[model samples]
Every structure is written in C-alpha cells, then in structure tokens.
Target: MQVLRPQTSGNVDRVLDCHGNKVVLISRRRVFSLTAGCATFLAAPYLSLRQSRASDAIELPEVRGGGKIRIGLLWSLTGHLSVIEKPSRDVALYWIDEVNKSGGVGGYQIEPVIMDAKSDLKTYRSAIMTLMRDEHVLATFGGYLSVSRRAVMPLVTENRGVFYYPTCYEGRECWQHIVCTGPLPNQHSLDLIPYMVRNYGPSAYFVGSNYIWARESSRNAIEWLTQAGGQLLGEKYVPLGQDNFDVICKDIKNKRPDWIFSTVVSDSDIFFRKEYARQGLSSDRVPIASLTTSELEVKKLGVSYGEGHILSAPYFQSLGGATNAQFVDRFLGSRFGESGVTHFNMEETYLAFLYFKKSVERVLQENGHVPLTPENVRAFSGGLHLSNEESPEGEVHLDPDNLNSWLKPKIGRFNGLGQIELLWQSSEKVSPKPYLLYPERGVCLSDGLHLPNGTIVKAAS
Candidate 1:
C-alpha cells in the first residue's frame, strides 16, 4: 500500500490519496480517516459499546427508502383568490426548501409539484385530479378559499388523498380525506359578535359577496348579533365578480349602522375598502369588522384604505410568541423579505405542513417504513395532532368525521402601517362542531317568516 500524503502544501489539515480516499490530520501526530464507514467498521465492537449514546444523538424513525418525496401543491396562484393563495404558495415553497436543507423529512428529500388553480372551481378540480392521478403525488396541501376546498373535498375523499384546507369557513361539512386547518365560524364569528356588541353597541350592517360561505357566515353573524341585543341595520348581497360597489356603498351610507360586519370574500374586499374610503368614512367612525381580511389583504389594500380595519382569524403577522416570531422571521426572510411578511394563507399552509410532518413521523414510528403514498398519508393524518405558536387558535385536534383540525380565532386590527396588531383572543378554545347552529337558525327563521323588503329588524325592541 502507498502512503497517502496531504494534497495541500505546508501545514495540511486533510489528505487525499490517488484512489480519492480522504483522511484528516488533526495535529502533528494524531491522524484519522475521513470516511465514517471505515471508522465505524474498524471500531465495531468499540462503537457497539457506545451504541446507546450514539443512538440518542442519531434518533430518527427508520424510513424504508432513500429518495425524494414528491408533494403536490395545488393553490390559486392567479385570479380572484391569488392575493390570499400567494402567501400559502410562498410558505409551501419555503417549507420545501427548509426541509431539504435540514436533510429532508423522514430522510427523503421533498420534491414539490406546484400547480395553479386560478381561483376557478373547475380548475381546482382539474388540478387535484392531475396531482392525484397523473403526478401521483404522495400528498397535497394548500387551499385558501372554502369554495375550492368544497369542490375538491369529494375528489380527495374518493381518492383517499390528503388535503389541508387553510381558511376559516362554515363548519357544517367534514371529510376524512381533507384536513381543515382553519377556524370554524363559531370559533371566529359567534363569540366575536358578542365582543363587538359589548364594546361597539348594538347596531350593525351586514355585507357579503353572494356565495355559500359568505351567505352562511353572514347568517351566523345575524344570529349572534340578534342574540346579543344588537339590531340589524340592513343586509346586502353582491355577486362575487361584481366590481361596482356604488349601490352597496349607498346602502351602507343610508343604514349608517354602528359598525359594518362584512363577510365579503376575494376581490370584493378591495372594492369595498376603496369605496368606504371614497365615501369619507374612516374605520374609527364606522369600523368594518370582518372574518376574512387577513394581513395579506391589508398589504394588497395598502395603508391608506386598510387602516384600522378589524379582522377575526386565528393567525396574524404580529402575534406575540417565540414560535410565531421565528416562523415570521424565517418565512419573511425567505419569501417576502424581512419587512414584507403578512398574515395570509401562508400561516395556514405552514401549519398544514407541520401537521403533515407530525403525521408522517407518527406513521413511521407505528408502522415502520411504510410508503408515503396518499392513502398512507390520509391514514397517518387521521390521527395527527398539531400545535404551534403560528396556530394562535391553540392546539388543533383532528376531527373524527372529516379528519380536519379546528383552529382558534383571534381578533386583529390593521394599524395603517402595513401591519396587523392582535387585539383580542377567544376566551376559550372552541371545539369543532360540524353543524352550524347559528346559520341554520337564521335560515330557518328567514324562510319561516315573511319579512317585507327594506324592513329593519330589531332584536331588543
């Protein structure tokens, strides 16, 4: 055997022979091979003597294969929900990068397959089908709007795939395949009305885009408002794609309620805000408390128009906590820059990935080296438990019926400085109740009674 010499001149730290083997010279006398395999084999019994200590340091669930785990991310990259979905897309990308950097999940690198839903129901359906059947993704995550999740829920269930829907919505439906990582209306809307009424008095205006979510959410708001001795000034419904808010603004101005309880979704929020600003109505004069306005929307709406707007949701960029701060720092630094982080779909997306990670780890621990297929993921996530600072809503437990987790809701306000400040929190953790009693009650009452058009209903009168 030929003696290997250091490649570098003078004092050398390492040596590489002609055969491309490596060795390290720590001092004038001490020398060792750079190959861990060689080291392990030479010191087998000695290594076995210290196996317990080494095992603790190298503790990880045994994964069957060493490869890349392909994850399909279906999000609204463009179109009506782009503003909300973009953050989620960014977060998913960030998670993929981070996981790869940290040696990946379960010793497998994550390969992300991204597709844009473009906010269209048909497009969402097609994207999920493609990711499931064509791409054969191990799992899928990211949905911002309730409509999109609703459209794909059946497909995901039928395919036995995993979907993490990150949006506050009506909680009447649940599926075993899809995991709702957002708050239900009761967690967000029910108690919020009481809080608003106690602080802002008992008169409110209801405005929303014409959709299943908005309609149902508004109905629940009406019930809570009525129950709290609050009077309904008036209610208006506008079509989803309608841009002109002139009529709605006029209605709001005429009603002049104490506060505007809005359930507007998508681009309607921008239109409503601009219109409200144009009407010379500041948030202080007639504050608009909403269920959907997140930090992402505030950034898009700009400081002038988004200032002082109140929102009730689980996550915010300014939430105080070590975990939240770290998450914000990492997420913003990687995707949106240090100062550009916003509260949007990203928080939910991040939580979804973490939930998936936990579920996968659980599967590995229990089943040992199972394939990370969609069915395996669904089975794993069925019993997944996720708790994090980003989830201000508290610990989210998977619901047995739908396999979705219930997120807590918090109240935040846009401070006109491109930041959202947390204001209030749910007094208690709200459990996931599948049936929306408040909205159902409102629907039943409205259908049963024949109230004349343009009639103002008073709860306390």
Candidate 2:
C-alpha cells in the first residue's frame, strides 16, 4: 500500500507495485529496434494481458493450503552490472510468474526475496547472508561475475542452501549446493577455437575484466588456442567498469592478432567494442570474438558496433525455430521489453527456474507431501532433461555428476541488421566439463569431489 518514490539511478526507472513487492521498470531508451507501428501492435495486447493477469493474481487470496515458497534473487540492479543483470533477474521473475499463474509450483505460491548487490563483493556476501539466515529461502539465483559467485559460495555451502548461477563462467569447480545452467569452457571453446583457427588466422589476443571468470576463461582459451596451433599475441585484464580501452586498443593495433577473444562484461563490454571500432579495427580481418558479448551489449552499443564480430553462446535472439521465435516475441512484448533481446544469460536463468519447477514437481510426486528442502530439490535436479518446446534452445540436459547443463554450443556473428546470424552449432548437446584441465575434479559426490584418478575425497561432516 506504500508507494515509494522512483529511484534516480541511471540503471533503474520507476518502481511498480506488484502486490506488496516492488518490480523495477525498464527504461524507455532500451526498446527494440523494430518499426514503431509494428512494435506497438505486437507489444500492446501482450502487455495488457500480462498486466491483467498480474492484477488478478494479486487480488485473489491463497487458493491452495500450500501457502508461499520463498526464494532469494540476488543481482547488481543499480551499478555497473545493471544493464545485463537486471534483465537476467527479470527473466527469472518472468518464469516465476508463469509458474504461479499455472497453479503455482507443487501447490505452493512462490515469494522472492530480491536484493541488489550493487556490483560489490561485500554487498553480495551480505545479501546472501540475509537470504540464508533471515529470509531462509529454499534457493537463491543470481551472480554475473566469478568474484561475486566466490563471495557467496562458502555462505551457501555452509548453510546448505541452493544457489543457481545462470551466466557462462570459467568452469573450474562444482559444488554439491550449486547448479550451473550456463555453458562451461569446454561447452563453448571446444569447437569455437578450432572454428576460428580454421576460418581466421592462427594468432589471437585476449582482453577481459580482471577477475576469476576472465582469468580462468582466458586460460581455457589459451589452452584451446595452443592446441589449434594458434599463438597468443597478447593479453590484458582490466578492472570491471573501466571504460577507457585506449591502451589496449593501441596494443591490439600493434600486435595485429587475427582474432580478439573478449571476456569483458556489462558496461565495460559496450565501451570496449566502441573503442575497438573507433580505433579503425575492422571485424572482417581482425574481428573481435567474444564469450561474454551478446545482443544486449550490441543493442546498447548500436548494431554497427557488432557487425561482423563473432560470439559464442547457447542462445541468441535472432535464432530461427518456432520455439525461439515465440520466445523472442514474448520477450519483445513483456514488461521487460526494454531489454530488446533475449540472450544467453536471460535464457539460462529461465532454464534454471524450469529445472527448479520440474524438480520440485517430481519430488512432490514421489514423496507425496514433503518439505521442499534444498537437499531434496538439489537431489532431484541433477540429470534432468527438458524438451525442445519447453526450452527455447532446443533440448538441454543437466549432468548428474557435475550439476551443469549439457548445453548446445553455438557460434554467431552480428550483422548490420541488428541481429546475430548463426554460423555454427553443435550437432547435439555438449556435456559440461567444469574442470576442463583436471578431469579428476569434475565429478561431484555427496561427501565431496573425485580426485584426478577417480578417487573420492570425502567431506568431513
């Protein structure tokens, strides 16, 4: 019943009252590049229907005695990461809304405890602590950067709470308490590096944000690059939110690598692409190939900034297929339409919720009325499969051993038409290898992880 004033931050627009919870509105500047008339025609009824459903749900009392199932949503909603992470959070909410509309999850209405980490590590820790101890959520989802993930890993593990990470990361470790739906290094670069080497030249340069994700992902890139007989011309890791890429641009110009592999994220990603283009580096000859860049960044930086550039991901907004077409249309018509496009991060978050919902349903069916504890949810989530219609990105499977999704890898190039054109994709889903280098540490056990030689390292309880 309390209407708070709008936040003046550049990352957020006005807040809406969804029942008692506040949902952040998207800014007008981020709308899709479609024609005004077409966009309005497509989006109007969708928005109206969504708003009406939200109202009906809010007005209605609890239909089932299952009550509310609380979960935590952590993201940097007002800092450097707001651009991508906000949409990611919105996608999670989107799936949550759909779940509630369809009779709730296992007869329980879901309630989310949303918090902003502000792109700060300390804030991530504090928020997870509150979600764990105070909110006591069944599971928490969100974390764009590796450092933020590391900041909250121990807390989630120690408390035995579930955490779902939705972005591609440097896959090095897998914990029993966390579920990673994003593609790992092997899932992405296993084919990407060889494809680049075959089509482009054999020399590459690396640029990324200074953190565990960039450092570890670059390490995997180098491993694959070396295996492909490619040379590493140079490498650099800048701090997050660092906009100026002049020095790095100069180095790239001098080194003249055949391709540039970028791991920079958020606002920094937009700045890097703009600076690289401003330096007169043509994507045709010395294109920038990235694991982190997506349609969201390209939309913000302008379609021209991404023309001819290569990107590897599990999903892209421009992907063809009836399911993907419907997915994109729904996104373009939703309250979060300001995002303009659906990318890997948002899609993976949607997949995570799907996984959660299916797992909870299975658990309920088997147990016949039991508490949806973190352990029960985690136990059933592994080795789950989702059909093509259910998942926008074809069919996907979650590996039982590693708790990471067996994702279909894809390579795409941004064209002048403001969309990424698919170039290559795995014939089938690729199993995730979190520890790409050390296979022994890849498998997960109840007590602990496996050793290099398949020996189980039991956890001390």
Candidate 3:
C-alpha cells in the first residue's frame, strides 16, 4: 500500500502517492479544479453544449399559454443502481405531480424530462447533454454515485445549470451549481463511528465498494475512528457488483473486529449482508454498520438477514410523528404503493423539490413577475430552510456557504418488520462540515466541528 502524505500547496492540502493517485482536498472557502479526466471530457462535450445551447440572455419559457417549465429527472431506471436510483426518480415524479396539483411553482407547471442513464458513465454523459441541449430543462436532478455526479458536473457548471443532488456523498466539494440535500461524512461518520465504538468496541474493519464514494467515506471513517481512540483491524474495497464476500467474511471472522463499517451500496449491499449472516455471524456479535443500507435494501434482504445491522440516515420511513406519518401515508397511497418504502435518498429527493418550489416563489416574490431562469433560482436557493410542516425530517437548512444541507443525523437498526427502529438522534440539526472543518491543531475528538470562520458548533450527543 502506498502511504499518502499531505503536503501544503498554496492554500490547498494535496495528498500525494496514494497508489500513484493524487487526491486534492479543497478548503471550504476556495474552489478547486475538477479532475484531469473530468477536465478532458469537459473540453469536448461541455464546451460544445454550452456554445450551442447556452446564451448570454437565455430565453425563459413563458408560463402562460401551455408553456411549461421543463425540469430534468435523470436516474438509473434499469441497471445495477436502479434499485436505489429508481425510488428517487419516483419521489421526483411524485413531487412534480404534487407541485402541479397546487397550481405549480410561480404560475408554471413543471414538465419533466426524465431519462434513465442505465448506471453507465457514458450513458450519463449523453443523457445529461440531452437534458441540457435538446430538452432544455431548467434544472436537472439525479446521480446516485459519485462517479455519475462527477461525470456531468462540469457540463452542469459550464452551462450554468442547476442540479439538485439527493445522495449522501463523500464531501470535499463545494459547487455553486449543485444543491446537495444529502448528508456528508461529518453527518454520517462523525456521529456513527463514536456510537459504534462506545457500544460495540474500539476496533473496526472497513469494507466498501471500489468507488470514490465508498473509498473517500471510508477514509473519513478511519480519521474519525482514530480520533475516538479506536483501532483499525483491516480495510478492503471490492468491485461494484462483487457478490462474493466469502473470503472477506472469513478474514473478518478471523480478525474478530468489534464492528464492520460497510460503505458497500446498491445490489451488492444486499448480497454482502446476506453473506455475512450466512457465515454464521450475527449482528448482535459483529454488526455490519452502514451509511448506505436503508429501507429499500432491508426489504429486499428480508428481516432475518437485515435486522440487528445499524444504519445512519437523516430520515427513515418507520419514523413516528404526524409529519412523517403524513409523508408516509401519502407515499404509500401513491402509485408506488407500500412496496415503495421511503429511504434517505427518496426523502432528500422530495426535499430538493420543496426547496426548488420555495426558491422559485422567493425569486418571484422579491423580483416581481420576472422571468424564471436557472441562474435566478440558483441565486435564491442558498441557505433555504424548511419547517417541520413542509419537511418530514422536522427542520432542514441548506447551508449558504457550501451549498449543502444542515441535516438531522439519526442512527437506527432494522426491526423485525424490516423497518428502522431509532437508536440515537441528534437533539437538533447538525451543521454540515463538508470540508471536514477540523481545527488547525488536530482532529476534534468531540462532536464539535471547527468551521472556517472560527465557529465551533457542538453536535448533539
């Protein structure tokens, strides 16, 4: 394994020699260049799309006379990621239908331009171009994987388009064109690692899919684990569709770590969880704690295989309260029916549209009958808050600084019925520390995170 050493370059901290891969960690205040691969791809399609479709004074579709505000919904409807992405697409469609029922946003009915990227990078590239060029969508929402997000991000930025990303991702990015409604590592790992260490033990084994989201999330998990005085047993990353974990489970059983930190997502997660149980292991002994497993996966894996494993997410379908109750009822009554159990991704997907609606209304209210464009909506969207009435998660705040949401962090385990039974929850919403925002001295061992402007906010215990 190549040891990566952090070196200061200007104001950025660059990690060198991580298996010959350069990792650039950007600060909260500054913007960093996209990856070389992303830059190269952008040089061709990104420019051509911007030049051909974008203009200095972009024409706004008139709300009157059958004019519709075309909103793009790009997701994997038929692929490995379809299990997760399709639910989000359904939520987006549900939100669109709900908005239109209420007379739409700012006197315009949303015309959805939906595309299935088929979980392929090349498909994502072409599909996003279709949304931006041919369909001329006002804003696009999709991307479950970090690679998919990175694939079309340059295009989104170059065209000055808006993208409401709903997946909880590995942070270190602050994009002006993206509104991230999902939690970051600080939201998931910070609260989850310590809780696991305290209850389970001070030793862990990391297993994740071989992808940017899993690798980077695991990297942060290790940092948080070390800070809490926990020991790492071993760490492994497997290919995306890797179904066999016989060797990995054998190693885990031999090492006998207190807990397994899993960043494995999608269909692979189901297989891994079942394989863990099939190895004569139980979560009561060595639980597979995950950031990605939700009601969606739990249902597929069944209660026998999924129960006792822990999950950390902002929202769960089984949560009690009138707000969540109403949200659940509405979704269950929808075309998706009971089978479409709401998860973290779907909740955030719905919240994205809520924010979009509020952002558009605010723009129209302040500017007074002005034409709605992606730029204006983007300008008004930062730092938007939704109350418990509007949000099922009680309260949500989109951080103006980083374009990420301040989310309520909750940890839970699957019950007998394949639903999340809440274990621990923050007293209030935890602020987003997408860039880590650790103190200059060292990693903060407590729940408190040091912000860029010198404010240290304490997370709920």
TM-score of each: 0.78, 0.85, 0.83
Q: Candidates ranked by lDDT, best first?
A: 3, 2, 1
Off by over 4 Å in 1: 1-64, 335-339, 387-395, 438-461
The parts of candidate 3 lying over 4 Å away from their true place are 1-66, 437-461
The sequence of per-residue lDDT tens digits that candidate 2 reaches over residues 1-461 is 12366664554344544544444432222222111222242233223223222222221111123667777889878777789898988787776766777788888877766777776655776677667665567888999877667667666665667899988887767577788889989988778887899899999999998766788888888888999999999999887788999999999999889999899888999888888888888898699889878888888888899899999999988877898888778766866566878888998998899898888888888887766687788889888998898888889988887688998999999999768899999897898877668664546555467676766653211
Question: Higher TM-score: candidate 1 or 2?
Answer: 2
RMSD of each: 18.4, 11.0, 12.9
- For model 1 the TM-score comes to 0.78
Looking at model 1, the pairs that clash are 175-402, 393-408
**Model 2 spans > 4 angstroms off:** 1-65, 440-442, 452-455, 458-461
- Please report, as a residue range, the 10-residue window in candidate 2 with the lowest summed lDDT: 54-63
lDDT of each: 0.66, 0.77, 0.77
Candidate 2 lands at a TM-score of: 0.85
